[model samples]
Target: MSSSLPSEKALVPFVSVENMMRLVHHIGIETMLAELADFIEADFLRWERFDKTPRVASHSREGVIELMPTSDGEIYSFKYVNGHPKNMAQGLQTVTALGLLAEVSTGYPVLLTEMTLLTALRTAATSAMVARRLAPKGARTMAMIGNGAQAEFQALAMKAVCGIDHVRLFDIDPLATAKAARNLAGKGLTVTSCTSSQAATEGAQIITTCTADKQLATILTDNMIGAGVHINAIGGDCPGKTELHRDILKRADTFVEYPPQTRIEGEIQQMDPDYPVTEFWQVLTGQAEGRRDNSQITLFDSVGFAIEDFSALRYVRSKLDATGLYQELDIIADPDDPRDLFGMLQRAK
Candidate 1:
């Protein structure tokens, strides 16, 4: 390692929430989600290379904060995110995040950016990607049980990636459903606001549950689900936070991102510890079967994982040069002599 500091290494590029929104608009939301899906798929294909583990977490009465980190031998990435289901009532996002990717050898941050909106985007992308594999062939309709910050993104990503053309939405809050319907108006999707979860799933082929309440809420009952439908359960992403009834898990061919973490944070947390689950990467890579037949119910127990954030960071970095949407922050200090930190401070004074 060189004793002298490199200018690029000392300055970290930061993408604020404002810039992240701008970048998404500049790239087009659906297009970015599609590209993000490509990046995520690429990473999942080579899953063994990256160091994967459960997130380090701290839980409070109001919410939970977590650090998700991963490395692929050369580069490393981590994201700081929070989940507060009640924040929306106070005019705040229920979830927010920031992420960074660094060179493993240098151990210096290279890129830093907001992940709140990005998390919604990637969560949707991950859901849509999984649905493409597990959904019934030529599935075109989706029943979205939760209509909140993540609802619109989930609808759009399904349309863009999974070729779903219609979305039926249901939410306990009518305003939320209206907001989601309005946002998705001109996006080339057929959107309908339903009165109940059962109504939303009336004719749907893919069912997506992303409710925000951090409890074991049964958004979908076993009798409500029929054979041959693909279910994307993303909201039940924390301890004691699950959306579907346990009977549904027993009937479906369940799949997950990381079993160790999902066992603690995902819907499967309700099941026995030794419950059988197929890792999604295997389905993506053709190593394991997804839906056996048209009538085989499939479930994706999605609890957001570090590898997804790592892939999102890499995707954002790849776009920076072309978009120039980041500002450099002087977060690290530089000295004429790396060994004389005190002398450098003395000279500055």
Candidate 2:
């Protein structure tokens, strides 16, 4: 009777950054971005379908670590990411991450993949997704305020998603700007390095603030922003971190991913608790409006959300399954007999 039970084994897939990049290259960045946008929009329309929660954040004197988890009744996903701005001074990336995908039905993991690269990809993807709905038509120029690891991804996503062909770049570190410009060369866009934030914002249709500072640094002042400009605020995602001046938020018709979480992490945190801001999902679903007038300023206060990670994980899983680019692992255990869980451990010894 015991022998008739199932084998004490389970299969899961493990993927690496190299494999993930191969998958991305095969599928083409434009196609992947389009599909991810579709998934995000679909998920947004069915907002009630997900079990949402704010991320668990662990703060340190040097930086902050976060775990973002979410489920949709069947699939569960979570990302382990850390943000250490000062680490770059020591030659480490400002942000590093990894994530897991699981089957909720049996609590089994499906994939474990490094997210350092994926995080950059998804953050850029999400920024572009929001910009599509909020930015004014015929927008071509973008001001990228931060020239760190995320700068290239943001620039690529904008080009693929928003038809942006020129990027005006600025960073506190000239070398960082040079690195971004070097990465973006021959990507069909003109990259200009600027010395000041005000210089970068001039004549730009969209402004993206992805600075990697843990302090309350204001990258964009109120007077620097112009009408019909769409601001993608990405860096100010935790308590004590912000990029935009409070007055810029006061004039713009601000949009955020999730209000409850954004109030705590987005640039809106500087404003009152009752500050009126529209959820970008609402704009996607047509439940609310975006960019009422051509001259109106639009702000997307992006604090990398769990749903974006969910969409990213879903896309990666689908690609891996279709291409067989992942390796299977024994991440879960099954006992040959019911109530023999302890015996299985003994058998291994």
Candidate 3:
């Protein structure tokens, strides 16, 4: 049934990463991440309520690009994030991103924002949200295996959401680890630079792998991982890329964002097609168990799902609306006559 509603022709804003950083500074990163994590967890518990899809990836010799799109009956959102590890060599970010949010009712765009920074924030928030459910109690220390642009966000999110106060940081590039430590110095966490993945996991209850390697590198071996540790495997999100040894998956009870997507992109891809792994949403909703025992190892085989981006965009849209810190662009056509779909081009000329 169609009901009479006000025809509100409103233009939303486009926010850049710099503008987002200003907003983050005003709202505080901890608050932003905490709120974002709340949104993610809330959405996760209602997993069946969302319209989810696997991200579409475009691959190149240097790296890969991805488009993640999702909807929840009312709102539609999508993010464009590129992963070019070689971009860092040219002084550019390894992953650059932007996204759009639209109203499903009218198909009108609500907001467009740069997601390079927001992606890092959302990734960290998602990881922390999963850790809260899967990690052992009193989990204060974390081992960050890859210290890149995402390292600081992961460290801060762990501190903010999971109560992790100590981080043992490691990177093949000493400079990367140093940069992460410097960024996290006064963030109320004790940061340590470790020589190897084993050293980093020494006393850490949660180990996060955010490396950028494109190969099936085993950042966490079964020997280095201890019981009751929660592994946030983020880098092995693409096909052919992995961070944990296959043996580690056998030892730990693994959880994932989406079973079908993660089966292809996550570390579980190494295992047989019939390998058993639980969907994180199942645990969040009490349909499945998390951290079965104190001595059990838990792994979050994260592949950076579309739902995470959906939550992030929803949070960003709210903040941008509240602060009035965005610009509107005519990316969508609005014809004077509803039937004149092709008139936009003529009118522009």
Give the number of the best model, judged by TM-score: 1
Candidate 3 whole-model C-alpha lDDT, 0 to 1: 0.88
Encode model 1's per-residue lDDT on 116-231: one tens digit a residue.
Answer: 98899999998888888899999999999999899999999999999999999999999999999999999999999999999999989999999989888999999889989999
Every candidate's lDDT: 0.92, 0.87, 0.88
lDDT by residue (50-168, candidate 3, tens digit) is 88888888999998888999999899999898988788889988899999889999998888899989989999999999999889999999999999989999999999999999999
**Could you tell me the TM-score of candidate 3?**
0.94
Worst 10 residues of 1 by lDDT: 1-10
Off by over 4 Å in 2: 1-9
Quality of model 2 by C-alpha lDDT: 0.87
Residue-wise C-alpha lDDT for candidate 2, range 217-332, written one tens digit per residue: 88999999988899999999999899999999999999988888999998988999999999888887788998887799999999988988888888888887589878776666
Could you tell which candidate, 1 or 3, scores higher by TM-score? 1
Score every model by TM-score. Answer: 0.97, 0.95, 0.94
RMSD of each: 2.1, 2.2, 3.7
In angstroms, the error of model 1 at 219 is 0.5
